[model samples]
Target: MSTVDLGDVDRFTVAALGPVGQRTFLLQCRSEQTVLTLKVEKQQVAVLAEYLGRLLRDLPRPGHLPEDLEVEEPVEPHWVVGTMGVSYDAELDRIVLIAEELVPEDEEGDAARFTVTREQAAAFAVRATRLVEAGRPPCPLCGGPIDPSGHACPRTNGHRPPTN
Candidate 1:
């Protein structure tokens, strides 16, 4: 399998497109001349943010996080992400993010590896959390999204209509 090593990324962030109920999440990163975008699920973004937040807590606080954390235009994803992992490099004081492309079990998929500064990591975590929270509100009883059309909450056994 081929792997794209985007060493020392300059920009990294997660973004969502479209409305709350019908949105597409993307994990985008850039290192100098190269830019990579990957399709990701909302749950993945949420979990990644949570994981990074926890990891950052154990490390020293970052100073002067990046502010222009917006998704670059023409968000053409290279591939749909299957699995992702992150780790810290103590010597370099950076965070490494690894993402593998989704593929059938019998086939091999490409992978991407990148490293970002602690400041970039912190910015990404905060921005990703905000992007995930911008989605449709979850149902109180079932914790499922309350779609604008309607949500047949399984908790109530379809007995009541959605309130929001």
Candidate 2:
């Protein structure tokens, strides 16, 4: 719903991660045990709240937590997103979504930013050239099988782009 659903977060703190020029928030879910992450657009908050209330109203009474809109309780078992299963926590009086945090791990060489040296770049080029020469087909850019072609390109009226 919201970029960061508040349920599992602590103390009203929402973690916002960056792609620099874009406005986005990484919603984090943490228990005493684990943490999960998700990124979403900011405008979805109101819609998320409406759905949460609709989802939680099934509880007999006071299942909704006024102080924290993130937590929830349901009167019966239900499927979230029509798939992931979660239901009300009557004792806790909060609606809880049972899902593993959609967290992604960082791979080597990827970060906020980095500089590539000429020597390293040249070495990469040589290796790439050799790999390509070993027996790969012509670049789909020039000519090759349709599925193997990278683009959803088609000739129009028997007029193709100039071929290699």
Candidate 3:
């Protein structure tokens, strides 16, 4: 795809999902302002099968969405889902998701879609951040692990003992 500069974000169509469901495309580019999601269909997903983990970032268009995100301080850790795995009826495509569900000459009708609460989105984002941070070092609070087995932080879920 071609690249274009639009002030803060360098716009580009990273990948296109072909037929079937490759799921190989695994890319999340984040800047101070926004996040750009890139992914492949079932084939590409199969290719990257070995190194796949939890999602690291959720691409959000600053202009679009609820008022809270627009106010933009530091959003609480959220479990933000996206159009990656989800599919819709093209007609009901929102402006935020228009790019993902491109049509030939535009069409009519609504489509199936998935929505998430702010809290849930925040939680997802935090989890993704934790996963990325995991590769760096161990966290004192939880012994640095996302898996339930590493539920070591007493402060978080009261899994450990109280210190003197």
TM-scores of the models, in the order given: 0.96, 0.30, 0.20
Q: After superposition on all CA atoms, what RMSD does each candidate show versus the true structure?
A: 1.0, 20.7, 17.0
Say which prediction, candidate 1 or candidate 3, comes out ahead on lDDT: 1
Q: Which candidate is the best by lDDT?
A: 1
**Candidate whose TM-score is highest:** 1
Residue-wise C-alpha lDDT for candidate 3, range 23-78, written one tens digit per residue: 12233333446544543232333222211222212333223222222212222212
Candidate 1 lDDT, 94-123, residue by residue in tens: 898999999999999999999998899899
lDDT of each: 0.92, 0.32, 0.31
lDDT of 2 at 160: 49
Ranked by TM-score, the better of candidates 2 and 3 is 2
Residue 136, model 3: lDDT of: 27
- Which of 2 and 3 is the better model by lDDT? 2
- Against the true structure, candidate 1 reaches a TM-score of 0.96
